[model samples]
Target chain A: MSERINSAWSPSSREKERAQARKRISRKQAVVAAVSSIIVIGSLLTIVVTSPGWAVVKKTFFDINYGREVFPTVISGLWINLQLTFIGGACIGVIALGLALMRTTKSPALTPFRFLATAYVDIFRGAPLILIILLVGFGVPALRLHGISSNVIFLGTVAVVLTYSAYVAEVIRSGILSIHPSQRAAARSLGLTSGQTMRYVVLPQAIRRVVPPLLNDFVSLLKDTGLVSILGVTDAVRAAQINASRTFNYTPYVVAAILFLLITIPMTRYTDRAIRQRTNAQNAEGAI
Target chain B: MSYVLELSHIRKSFGNELVLNDLSLSVQEHTATVLIGASGSGKSTLLRCINLLESIDDGQIFLDGVEISDPLINVDEVRRKLGMVFQSFNLFPHKTVLENITLAPIKVQLKSKEEAVDAAMTLLKRFDLADKADQYPDRLSGGQQQRVAIIRSLAINPRLLLLDEITSALDPVLVNEVLSIVRDLKSDGMTMVLATHEMGFATQVADEVCFLESGNILERGTAQEVLHNPKNLKTQDFLKRVHQAGRL
Candidate 1:
């Protein structure tokens, strides 16, 4: 019986030919893409090298000796950026989770909290991150509140966490809302309390669904950590600026940029790979 | 003198649409009560109200003489004594069949994992689902998934089980398998209130049948009386349509 089923299930000659045709077309497209990218990059490089402005641009930006001389200060400054990203990212995760749950709760007693959460998300998401950093970092200190630290790094971290938490909260709330209502019904029908249902059943699935997008947010937040230099915390960009102004060379800026890319590129690539895997899993489930 | 489950003048509505209106019902202990109605006749809503999944606009529901539908009543406490199965078999997709069965037993009932797993395995083996216990709901056929859903509800050892169109979403070939599970539950003296469209299965398992029309019980009698000798014109008309469709 198994042999008969397998024999009848094999693809016909026409179907096999169609499959081969599709493979051939895809292979031809790959070759075209590869050739086009090489030609475009090669011609652009050649033009830049042969251009009249090439010598001055290279001396200002690509001077290897200047880059080496500024590397120590910029690397030290980059440590501050990493600290801000990691610490602020952790604080944002906690605050964002609370805000997301508040915004998504159906209880009438929580209406005020939900309203506040919604307002915070709307205002912060609508405002620019830099504007928020400037306002919080500068304006809070201007208030002269008792015992409040006016330190640039502390203020800057607080600003970044506040701004990013709003965006992350919105992402998490969307993930929670995307879950089918039937899942909640099923959980509640089984005698689980609403809190228990959310904690054990709803949240695990919601967090899994939002992981790729949440990682995407972290990548952006890591880059935004550079904006803290505006508050005079002497992070990578600030260090690069001091070096470039004193030496009349742009090499330190390139060094700082390379350092940022070193972290963000790998993270962005992982997020993309996660997204692809999620899509493939969904497609496989749909086919079944 | 107290019925096992009773609804008194229950009223429920969604927005401006009245789904159930002044509905009252009672089920004796260890008896199955099957609700028969057309698509929008409020059978599912009535069952949902009984399980406290839907809040009644005005009414009282009694379980063993206690008023469970009062606003001050803790719904979670009431739900623990009642089990419900849905039309689409809303088994947790992330959980295996055994895990699904054991989740409520362990989490809400506070049974030890070992005890829950043992009970779950016994039930799975009885249902011929022991081989599929480790498989997810998506990996099972619709019939198997529905059986697992029933088993999941039973794991709670509920006083009453509410089945809402449990066989409606299944294919005709698979419907018999799910219906047979209900039949076995009936024989085991499980108290159940089921909303179903299966007239033949209803006749076989139900001690009493209630024919609902526009959210009111138009007729109530033994299963044979309602299915074969319905008096109300609406019930007769509904049965005629079902018979002509060859479903009865």
Candidate 2:
């Protein structure tokens, strides 16, 4: 009678003993793996330095300009690409929300919606983004639908949204479904309608779970906007390409790459911090 | 006593399997009746049927003498008057206990937030958990959360309480606290129908005890008569096992 349910979830005596033994075994295994990995990495580094390639790095580091002057055009183009990436990411968010909601429904009325999402993702993600922009820039007027004005920037934005929405939709759906079914039941039992349940309980939890992935998607979406250069959208990559054409040097891409790193580095740091926070919370509860 | 709730000849099926067969039950105003039976005895199904949570293929249910067969009967209205406590507390995890209690009153019933909070505060206090009113369900112990759940249901000021194994999830030390609260409700004369395996509580406090087996009522009588001198063999056998389990 001494609070029997306190024992409800705690493991029995045997389980506790087994868990302790397993921890000891794993700790020993971890030490062995760490020692092995250090040895292998040390050998590889030594072999690389002793090889002929070591001289090339020394030659380039000394002769080449370690810090080249930043070009204004490259900086301006980098800014333009940032704008396009953000704009494209925003559209992905809205479309992903819609597609995620549609994926949960079984109604025949939503068949076209499901099919369209599926088809768009397959077509663009299957073929490269370069081809999609080429099609949008060339195919629309080529089909002669007769005087339908198409902007390259708009077309690039649309192409990315279409391609990324399907992937984002799957991420969001998993987030939504990961929520305990009890949360929905509690909302319903409290007299909130199904729509209210989704809006309040389901969406809040889903959004929290998807935040890291959403940030990752945004970082990648920025890189993917480089493909819009083929459509002549004048984004960062396109501006770099224009500069590279004029200078007859690939050095312009290095500028665009730096800008891309600038954008993604902060996001990666934030993702790591968030993951640490989440794991810390779980481990804290586990300890309790 | 006038009947506040009644179910007549209810039958429910899932494909080929019949779950509730020709089941019928009645509740008098301001009296607690506890249903006792083994697992698969359809006790939980019967509770769901009472609230229309589970649809019965063939049956009629009446709340306050108004039949619920017509499409016009608002299920929400019936549920508002018949508070139910589930085995799992099922409190909204994201919401604090005060918000959990006040949500229905403010949103569905259209009461002002101030009014709903005022009412919820009283229930939280009565459960001796006023300090926990701002805490989420996950922050509370299982017993404390279950007690909050009971109070949340009662916050609606239901005409009758339907408890489905209310104390089943409780630790042994916390079981009496819940049962004591239930026993105190009897003094207030709140009408109730409890589905429970707590034989001692059923024998000591219930106005009537109904023994159900396989979706049918095997025996029923006043608590004293059913516990002390059941005439049916199934009832006697059930009592013997119940006692051997140290529950009688």
Candidate 3:
């Protein structure tokens, strides 16, 4: 009986033939992929290099000396962009969480605050970010409010934080609502007060669920910080504009583009990886 | 005898739909009362009402003869004496099993973290779940999650435990692990009122069984009388269906 089972389980002639066929197909696929990549890339390269516009395009956007000349200016401007995004992102974190919590609160006393939060989100999320940056950047200083700096960087960061908070608040509110109501019941039934339940049970789960989307908003916020250039904030885009006009070459803009890509690409990858990890964790739980 | 928990003329409705009509029930100390009914029969609603998760439209609930349904009474204080296990086993997904169990103990009961952990460890060890202490709920099986949920409630040492369809969410094989935990709780003389679909397990553990139909108790008696020889036709028909379904 053991010998019979062993032979039955072992690779038969048909199984060997199938395995050999699979190997052959995979090898063919590898060769096909390599050939296709070469053909597609070679043709694109040939078209670009042989095109009539190639020389002007290279001279305008890809000049190595122009890139070198603009590198310091664009990189320095990126430092400002980094500072704006980080500071604005941090402020958005606190402001958005507060708004989300206020909007979600069941307290009747908070009704006006909830209305205000809703109004802010509706208005800001609907309006353009550029318009918001322009208005806050220029408008706040025109008001000449006491203790409020007229500095473009500070005003630009405020505008970015304001607009992004509306979006981030909605993201967090959705995450909180996505949690099952039964979780609240479980917590309350354990004698935890509503505040304790929100603090200990609900918010932690809600925050973890929203991490990916929050990171997405942060990446967008980082890119949108470039809009501060319109306010004369001297961010990467503004620096690129200045250098491009100075040398009459678009290479500076390309340099700035590369700098933005360098940061946004890594963040995008991290978000994808985090989302995959969450999905895998959920799948693993379901499997067991 | 004064009951551990008592409901008088309990009434609850959601929107325009009345879920529970004028219902009244009393649960004795150290006794298990199993509520059996079909879906949408108000079994879960009744449990939720008793736990104060749902406010009664009109009624009075008394825990240890103290009126709790009154608006003037502090609901949180009333809830402390009651432990509830939900059908979905809503363990805090972010917390480890031990953290899930210890949260209410430390937060609500004001026990030291070490004390809560000690108490939680004892319950976990008793349930053969000590190994899962550091694992999150998602890492555990449905049965294990449900067990951890039950342990979380038990950790508070509640005066009365309300279980709402606790085993209804488990697979056939996983049901026994949860049911046996209830059985152990019964043997330990824990005062529990449970709404369940497990008629067989209900018959085994219940001192008294109540059959709820359309927000009213169609039948109520000793488990033997209700489960084995129910007097009402509705109760008999329900049991016949249960038996046919091989659930009884």
Candidate 3, residue B40: how far the Cα is off, in Å: 1.7
Residue lDDT tens for model 1, B41-77: 9999898888888888998999989999888998988
lDDT, model 3: 0.91
Tens-place lDDT per residue, model 2, A46-127, is 9978988778654433222321433566677677677777787888889889988876655688888877766765665578
Report clash pairs, candidate 2: none
Q: What lDDT score is found at residue B68 in candidate 2?
A: 68
TM-score of candidate 2 versus the correct structure, residues matched by position: 0.81
Q: How much is the lDDT of residue B89 in candidate 2?
A: 77
Local accuracy of candidate 3 as per-residue lDDT tens digits, A177-267: 9787888888999888888888888898889888998999989998999998998888899999998888789999999999999999999
Clashing pairs in model 3? Answer: none
TM-score of each: 0.91, 0.81, 0.93
Fraction of true contacts kept, per model? 0.77, 0.28, 0.98
TM-score of chain A, model number 1: 0.89
- Model 3 Cα displacement at A181 (Å)? 0.7
TM-score of 1: 0.91
CA deviation > 4 Å runs, candidate 3: A1-16, A34-51, A285-288
DockQ of candidate 1 against the true complex: 0.77
- Docking tier of model 2: it is acceptable
Alpha carbon deviation, residue A21, candidate 1 (Å): 5.3
- Comparing 2 and 3 on TM-score, the stronger one: 3
